[model samples]
Target: MNRIEKRMQELQQRGEKALITYITAGLPDMEGTKKLIRAQEEAGVDVVELGIPFSDPVADGPVIQDASYRSILKGTTLRKVLAMVKELRAEGCEQPLIFMMYYNTVMSYGVQNFADACVEIGIDGLIIPDLPMEEQGELKEALAGREETVIIPLVSPVSGDRIPKLVGDAKGFVYCVSSMGVTGNGGQFHAHVAEYLKQVKAVSPIPVMMGFGIRTAADVLPVKDVIDGAIVGSHFIQLMEESGYDTEKAKEYIRTFKTELNA
Candidate 1:
C-alpha cells in the first residue's frame, strides 16, 4: 500500500482522525515549499496535498487563485514540483505526498507520462479537481501497473446519486467537499453538512475526508464522528501568507490546531 492508504489504516487502528494538509507546490518560492511540507509533517499532518500551480485554477477561490498565480509568475512548472518531491524523498521524507492539479495541466504534460513520473517519484495519489468521474478511464489505464499511485476521486455536497459511484472506486480517503463552492476559508457551512457527510460516509467503505471551508479545528469537531478526517487547504495557505511564509510558525500553529481538534 502507498503511504496514503497505510496512514489512513494506521489512523483507523488508533481510533484517531487523520490530518491532511494542502499547499501550492511553488508558493512563497520553490525551496520554501519543501520546508513547508516538512514542517506540516512534523506538526502532525498525516498527508500532504502538493498543489501543482496552474494558469487557470477554476475550482480555486480568490486566495488559492492568488497563490497559484504567484507561483506561476515564479515559473513553477509541473516538472519542478515533481523534482521537489524527488528531493524530499532523497532526504528521507516519507510523508504521503499527493498531487492536486487541474486536468488541463495533466493533458499538456501527457497523462501517462505524468502518472509514470508520480510512480517513479513515490507520489501516493493524484487529485485532479476538474477531472470528471466519466473521464477517469484513460487516467486509470495510465495508472494500471502502479497500484501505489492512485487517482483519488472527489465527492461534492451536491453529488446526488453520483456519490456512491465516486466513492466505490475511490483510492485514498474520499475528499468530500463540505460546501458547494470553490476552495476558500471561512465560508459558511450549512446545517445539512453533517447530513451530507453522513450520506458520503454511508457509501464510502474507505475513510471520508471533508474539505473546503474547513479552517479551524472547531470546524471539524462537529463532524469528527461522522467522517474519518478533515482536509485543510486555503486556510493553511492564508496562515502561511500571514506568517510571511515562515514555515516554522505555520507548524506551531498546526500543532495548536491539532490540540484543539483533539480536545
Candidate 2:
C-alpha cells in the first residue's frame, strides 16, 4: 500500500477520523510552502493534498482561486511542485502527499509521464477534479502499472447511479464533494450530506472522505460517524493568507481542527 492507503488504514484501525489539509504549492513561495507542509504534519494532519495551481480551477472558490492566481503569477508549475515534493522527501517527511490539480494541467504534462514522475517522487495519490470518471482509463492503467499511487475520484450528491461504478474502480479513498459548487467554507452543509455519505459508503469498498464545504471542526464533528475524514481547503488557505504565511499559526489552526474532530 502507498502512504495514502496506509494512513487511511491506520486511521480506521485506531477509530479516528482523518484530518486532510490542502494548500496551494508555491502560494507565497516555495520556502513557505515547505514550511506549511511540515507544520501540517506536525499539527496532526493525516494526509496533505498539495494543490497544483491551474489557470482554470473551476472546482475552487474565491480563496483557492486567488491562491492559484497568486501561485501562477509567482511562476509555479507542475515541475516546480514535483520538485518541492522531492525536497520534502529528501528532508524525510513521509506523511502522505497527494497532488490535487485540474485535468488540463496533467494533459499538458502528458499523463503517463506525469504518473511516472509522481511515482518516482513518492507522491501518494492524484486528485484531478475536472476529469470525468469515464475518461480515466489510460491514466489508471499507467499509474497502476507504475506504483500504488491512488487515483482518487470525486462524487457529488448529484452523481446518482454512477456512484457505484465510480467507487468500484477507485483506489485509495473516494473524495465526496459536500456541496454542489466550488471549494469554500461559506456554504452551509446540506441536510443531504449525511445521506450522501451513506449512499457513497454503501457502494465504496474503500474509505470515503468529504471535502468542498468543510471548513471548521463543528462542520465536521456531526458527520464523523458516517465518513472517514473531512478535507478543509479554503478556510485553511484563508487563514494562511491572513497570517502572512506564519507557519506556527497555520499549525495551530490545524491542531484546533484536529481537536474539534476528535472531540
Candidate 3:
C-alpha cells in the first residue's frame, strides 16, 4: 500500500480522525511552503494537501484564490511544485503529500506527463477538483502505471445519484466536500454533511475525508465518527498569512490545532 492508504488504515485502526492540512505551494514563497509542510508533519498531521496554483481556481474561495494568484505571480508552476516535493523528500520529510489542483493545469502539462512527474517526485496522491468522474478515464489510465500516485475523487452533497459511481472509482480516499458551495464560505457543518458522509462511507470502500469550512476542532468534533479525516485549509492559510510566514508561529498554530482535535 502507498503512504496514503497506510495512513488511512492506521487512523482507522486507532479510531481517530486524521488531520489533513492544505497550503498553496510557493505561497509566501517556496521556502515557506516547505516549512509549512514540515511543520504540519511535526504537528501530527496525517496528510498534507499542496495546492498547485492555477490562473482560475473555480471551486476555491477568496482566501485560496488570492493565495493561488500570489503563488503564480511568484513563479510557482507545476514543475516547480513537483521539484519542491523532490527536495522535501531529500530532506527526509515522509508525510504523505497530495497535490490539489484544477484540470486545466494538469491538461496543460498533459495527464500522463503530470502523473509521471508526480510519481518520480514521490507524491502520494492527486486531488483534481475540477476533473469530473466521467472525464477521468485518461488520467486514471495514466496514473495506473505509477505505483506512488493515487487519484482521489471529490464528492459533494449535490452529487446525488452519481455518488456511488464516483466512490467506486476513487482510490486513495473520497474527499467529501462539506458543502455544496465554494471552500471557506460554509460557516458550519450542515446536517446534510453528516448524512452525506454516512452515505458515502457506506458505499465507499476506501476512507472518506471531509474538507471546506472545517476550521476548528469544535467544527470537526461533532462529525468525527462519521468520516476518516478532516481537512482545514482557509483557517491554516489565514494563520500562515497572519504569522507573516513565521515558521515557528506556523508550527505552533498547527500544534495547537492538532492538540485541540485530539483533546
lDDT of 1 by residue, 150-227 (tens): 988888778989889998977888988888778884747755899999998988989988889888788888888898
- TM-score rank order: 1, 2, 3
Which pairs, if any, clash in model 1?
Answer: none
Residue 225 of candidate 2: its Cα lDDT?
A: 84
Each prediction's Cα lDDT score? Answer: 0.87, 0.87, 0.85
Off by over 4 Å in 1: none
Cα lDDT over the full model 3: 0.85
- Clash number for every model? 0, 0, 0
TM-score versus the correct structure, for each prediction = 0.97, 0.96, 0.95
Superpose all Cα atoms of candidate 2 onto the true structure and report the RMSD in Å to 1 decimal. 1.2
lDDT of 1: 0.87
- What would the per-residue lDDT of candidate 2 be over residues 1-263, giving only the tens digit for each residue? 88888888888998888889899999789988998898888878999899999888998889899999999999999999889889899999988999999988888899899988899889988898888988988888787655558888889989989999999967889999988888894647666888989999998999999898777878866678899888989888888888898989988888888777877
| Candidate 2: worst-modelled 10 consecutive residues by lDDT | 141-150
